[model samples]
Target: MAKQAKNHAHRRMTHQRQVISDCLKTLNHPTVDEIQTCVIRTAPTINKATIYRTMNRMVEDGEVIRIVGDDGAFHYDATLDAHYHMLCEECGALSDVDMPVLPQIDQYFPPDSDFRLTGHDVIFRGICSKCRAKKAGRNRAETGQN
Candidate 1:
């Protein structure tokens, strides 16, 4: 079961919610539009408002995490594990970064501050290998170099 939403009862997993969750897991990191597009394949009647409400509820229930991509759109992630991600600047691709979680960084919060540091999000931005290769190929073609 997903974590309960604060001040609200735990929402039961309905058929539509299950479908949404499964789609989220299958996707690497997808935005609402991407998710809705994928969802319509299995659930033809699901609408945009339903997707929005369900996603927002999932986030509130701790079943999903919303990340803002370079494109300035909200991306959904179901992987609750503590890890970072790499966003491809060239293609707007988002993928998990395979590395250990730096829990030590949590200690950096002001020692005397009253606020508690719950978590942190680290996103590395750059041109992914595929994008770099594509660019390189284009440059080579333009320059008449093999």
Candidate 2:
């Protein structure tokens, strides 16, 4: 029984490594289905259940970061660096926002408070520059102004 358990764990770890490798290659944060698709190309025998289980484990272990997109779907990213996500409201585009960590904000809650500060995920939602420019152009055209 112990040997069986060991083999199972080994297989899971192997699949997880492949999943993480595929995730790193993806530039954009992809959903579980997308990750599974990528893994399938390299590992034809890997099933969706294994992919999902491995991904969830990776997220829990902090090997991968999970972001809940503006569309409410979970997306995975392998970048461990501290960063936030920006969602373009008009175009539904998601991009990384590189900025300094604001650890000082946790002090505002008062150290004696019941709330224990751990971490934060900040997602800025606004129209991207391209979307704003497109809207402006449409407005000008509607107003009959070149």
Candidate 3:
């Protein structure tokens, strides 16, 4: 019975972890508050503290990454691999940008360079397609009235 109880507990934790992982996977870069809202939708019994603790543990284990945006909100991403992020200034949308040549930059640096470079983060901020279209529509409307 004791073994069965332990197994049940493990399963429960696994379920919670899966819920968090799925939430991150669906959203490109979700803030902690957003993730908490998602967690509630899936698992109402899960508390905010538990979600926070799990996210911290996942970051330490390299299962996820915590990105601090200009808004001061910490966002979570499940993609642990190195890649650049593009953020929409207008809509706050986050998307991944693929650059095959990014890895070649490392070769240019000296092997024994005094500075240690583990990785790099490149974030491009601009208005996204939707926001740009909206702005154009507004301009057209104003011109039509004139």
Candidate 4:
């Protein structure tokens, strides 16, 4: 019976986990809070702890990548392809950067260096277009330009 239970557990994702995973896939680099909000829509009884545990497990299983924004919040992504991220400084929005990854940078080493680079994460930070537009509008209003 124990063996059967173990096998059953591995057979598929739990409904709660599936819901959380779906949220991760649908949302654009959502934080835990955002994920909870999305997950609650379908699984109203699921709580924050379960969501956090599931997301952390997914990260440990190498199924999701965690990105940190300027707000110091951990955002989750399900994209397994090689890519970088850009964070909006003004609104704390995060988006994927489709630029090619330069593997040569990982090969570069110091003289007689023993350091090794297993992987890399590069995050470019800037104000997103929406935030930029809002700032421009605020500036115009302040200056009475229109």
lDDT of 4 by residue, 32-86 (tens): 9999999999989888887888888999999898887777899999998879889
Best by lDDT: 1
Cα RMSDs of all predictions? 6.0, 3.9, 2.9, 2.7
lDDT of 1 by residue, 1-146 (tens): 34446324424337779889989988889988889888999998888888999999999999999999987988899999888999999889899999998988988878899887788889998899999999998999989963
lDDT of 2 by residue, 21-41 (tens): 665567477777777777777
- What is candidate 3's lDDT per residue for 43-70, written digit by digit as tens? 9998888888889989999999888777
Superposed on all Cα atoms, model 1 deviates from the true structure by an RMSD in Å of 6.0
Which wins on TM-score, candidate 1 or candidate 4? 4
lDDT of 3 at 12: 89
The lDDT values for all models are 0.88, 0.78, 0.85, 0.86
- Give the lDDT of residue 55 in candidate 3: 90
- Ranking 2 against 4 by TM-score, winner: 4
Q: Worst ten-residue run, lDDT, model 4?
A: 108-117
